[model samples]
Structure formats: C-alpha cells, structure tokens
Target: MTHNPDFKDGAAYIGGEFVPIGEAKISVLDWGFTRSDAVYDVVHVKDGRFFRLDDHLARFERSMARRRIELAEDRQALKDILVRCVQLAGLTDSYVAMVASRGRPRVKGSRKPSDCANHLVAYAIPWIDVIPLEVQERGAKLLISDHPRVADEAVDPTVKNYQWSDLTSGLFDANDEGFDTAVLCDGRGMVTEGPGFNVFAVIGGGLVTPERGCLHGITRQSVIDICGKEGIVCRAGDLPRADLETAEEVFLCTTAGGIMPIAQVGERVIEAGAPGPVTRRVMASYTAMHEDAAYVTFVDTPTRFAAAE
Candidate 1:
C-alpha cells in the first residue's frame, strides 16, 4: 500500500493515537472483529462539511440501543470524534466512518475483571470521486439475488452492525451473476434494498422509496425531502421487482454514493438510459445544502507566519 504522506487505508485511530494500519490491532478473539459483532455509521463530507450529522447520530444511537452495546462516549463525544477524525486526516473532501463494536465478552483487554462487552473504532479516509451520470448515458445494472436480505429477527434492520456476511454474500452472488449490485428481497419474496443502500423508484413522476423496516437510509430521507421541496409527490413504501420495469426513474442513495441512477433491470431499460431530470435536480439541491452546513464556516490564517518560517 502506498502510504501517502498523509493517507493510509488500514491506518486508523484507537486509544487517541494515529498508528500504522498494520500496527493498530484488534484481537482475533475479540467479539467485535472475530464474530463481526458491532455497529458503524458513516458521514459524508462535501465542501468540508458533514451532511446530516445530527440525523446520523440519531440513527447511531438507535443502532447502539438495538444490540445493547454500552459506550462511554455519548452524543457530544461522538460529535467530537467525528471532528477529530476529519482534522487528523487533513481532508477537506472525503467520507469519514465512526464504528463502535461490542467489546470482547471474555475480559481479554480490560483490567476490569467484570468484562468488556464493547469497543469504539473511528477513522477517516479520502473517498474516490463519486461518479456522476452523463446525460443519456446508460447507468449501472443490478441482478436479483436468490438470497434474501438478513432476517429482521436475526438482526434489527436499523442497526449498522458488523454482522454483514449475509450482505457481502449477496453482493458476491450478484457479481457472480454478472451484475453491479445485489437486489435483496425479504422472506415474503418482496424486494427490500440493494445490500447497503436504499431502493427507490419514480413511478409516474412521484418519488417512491421503501419504508425502513429493513434498511433505514439517511440519504433516502434526504432525497424524499428534496422531492418535497421541488414540488414532486413522494412516497415511502415497498417496491417490488415487478414494479422496476414499469418505473420512470430508479436510483440508489448512500453517504459515500450520492444518487445513482439505474439504467436497466434484466432486459428492460428505465425511462432513459441515464439520470432523469428529477434525479439531477435532487443531486444539485443536495449539493447546495452541503454548502450551507456548519463546517463551511470561514477559515483565516496569520498573514505573517510564512515570513517567520
């Protein structure tokens, strides 16, 4: 790995220090890493600001409560961690991830004889530029996976837990099927979402996204909010595989990935080969909102510092 003067992939923060990716370690026996026992949240940075931090934190708290992973750092602490990570990376454009996992239950790394059931891991990385759609260009394709999404009973849909072998498996299944992503269904054979992102469709100029009992996407809510602002009718409900072919526009949303347009499903094409007018408008509007966020506050430096150096 090219350890740029500043960035490293496996490099991360733990116990308040920046360490080499190889040196910073977790246990083979730790519940978090070993069994994928944990939760995580990601915040997107555009023009040096985190989009919907409060909303992300709210969902994060919900994730924590879902698995009962106790943490010493609460909301304010989370906010501080987010800022510190961004500052450490010295990145003005990129995505930052804040992850908290259930600590090893066997009392391996802690002095407290009682037991440590959770741990917190946080880091930041400069993200690759998001691919934007060119007008009339065909969007990526998706394949329907025979495997369904993780059951709601095995894990609550809201928590961004680390137990994602099932999700990854779905992606692999899709790749093997020669598609870009995996469209997962519920036990009822109803389409839920693309492994990590929310599923959305445009049916007759109305914005339709799935309601979250399976995946609660912050970006999905942003899109819905943008639709409301632009005077487009919007709905959040179940969308089936059958509805995809007839839809006017279809897209996926996530923190790192902005709105992504889907060009085709199976042998059928969406309304156009590329992004529609509505998707373009929402993406533009969301960009404007990012500009007005708190982190965009003015920056100033001492004028004479360079002369002293």
Candidate 2:
C-alpha cells in the first residue's frame, strides 16, 4: 500500500489502467473535448474520509443517464476507482472527480451521438477551494454580471455538464472589475449561480437561494438541512437582483468550499464588509457534520485499493 513518489502530485484512472495524473489524456477528436459532450461530478475527502459519498455517486450516475453516456463501470466500480486514485496519491484530503465522456464516433465521419463510444475517467488531486482561503476569511467580493445564464430549456442545469460559456464570460468581467467572482442571472434578472457554486441570500431574517437555473448542489442541500436542524428559515425560490443586492448577508456553497461568506455584491457592501453571525454559525455546523458517522465514509485504502486492482 505504499504510495508511489511519482503519484505524489496526483493520480488518475484511465483506459483500465492507473497512471500519474499528468499522464492522463483523451483524444482530441473526442466529442467530450470537441463539443463539450460530457458529464462530471466532484466529491471531496477530508481527514481521510469522503463526505456524502453516496449522494455524490447518485448524482454522477443520474448525470450520465441524463446525458445518455454509458460507461463500462457501474456505481460500485466507479467508487472503487475513485478510492484507488486517492490511495495511490497518498492524499488524506483531496478533490476527486468522476467524469463520463462521449468519445469519438465508432464509424468514420459519423454525426450521431449514439455512434460515439462513451467512457469514464477519474482523478484525485490535492484539496482545492473554489474561493481561496484568504478570500474566504475576508469574505468574497462578487459581481452581478451582465452575462445571463444559459436558458434551462436549452441546457438542463440539473445535469452537471461542461457548458460554461456564460459562467466563464461573467468571471472574466468580474476579474476585470477587480472582484473575486461573478454570479449570473436569468433573462428576468433573477440570480442563478456563480462560477462553480450556488448563491444564497439572507433577507429579512430568512435564507433564500435560486430555485431554478442552477445546479442542485450537495452543499446547498447540506446548508438547508443545517437550517432545518437549527430552526432557521431557508427556502429555494426566485431571488430578484434588488433583493439580493440589499440582503442582510450573502454566501455561496459548493463541494470545493462549504460555506463562503460574501462581503459585497456589485457596488453595495454588506454588514460593513464582514461575515454575518448566521453565516458563521452555518459554517461551524457544516464543518462539525464532517465528523458525523451518518455523513462520512472513511477511506479504506488497503481494502478498497487491493480489491479494485
């Protein structure tokens, strides 16, 4: 069970073989690469255990089903590959991703999606935060970008896909304005989500997040669960820009960063530019839940990896 020095940086499972992360590759002609025809899900490990592993796996499976991308590995096999990647990298805390991609078509010059082969690739790397630690400490500055999120009718937000034209454009605008990140809105100016996270607002002593045009993030659900346990009013519904701009407090939730407080939205600063008490409480509760047996699956490095190999 010794870790390979070459895999210290990271490890990957590809083409029925384990390899260093840098060696992982997909053909340029792949539909997943050329046309962004792929679905992926990320699950994080903290303190040598995966948080909500089953929930993430379920979501990953659902995404693949929705995209009609079938792979050789089933749910249990996918779990084994992810665990093996983490073990090979010798990482206690890591960011793991499971991806199902539409490969190149079987017949030459074929255009039908069904003709293309589908495959899965997975990797585990050092832990990462969507919002940097320092920014989270000071609370992030977010820009309400003019770029609107892709219409739900055209692209299903429920399935995790690689369609990020709107998100990337918004992020570019945010960076140019000297902000940390940006959140896109719907056609009617209702807030949707940020780059890789879900948005939340505390208004009039209640918590609200966008009910449409955003990913049903696992962390977002966790926050809602914490609110229920703590007797906090939280709901998912239409959130107008004006309401969000003048809210008492705002924060973001993602698999990469659990509860990230926001100091400013566009031009207005919130609570004198500091994380509010509600946010602090929720953050503490979220961190504590990592230790709860019901929510965690400890990494069985030796047992799982041996069986997987």
Query: Could you say which candidate leads in TM-score?
Result: 2
TM-score of each prediction: 0.84, 0.97
lDDT of 2 by residue, 9-102 (tens): 8999888778899889999999999999999999999999999999999999999999898999988888888888888888999999998999
Q: Cα RMSD to native, each candidate? A: 5.1, 1.9
lDDT of 1 by residue, 141-227 (tens): 766677777777877777886666666787898678776776777776666777668777788778777664356888878787888
RMSD of 2: 1.9
In lDDT terms, which candidate is top? Answer: 2
Output the lDDT of residue 222, model 2.
96
* Candidate 2 wrong stretches, greater than 4 Å: 1-5, 301-305
In candidate 2, which residue pairs get closer than 3 Å at backbone N, Cα or C atoms, i.e. clash?
none
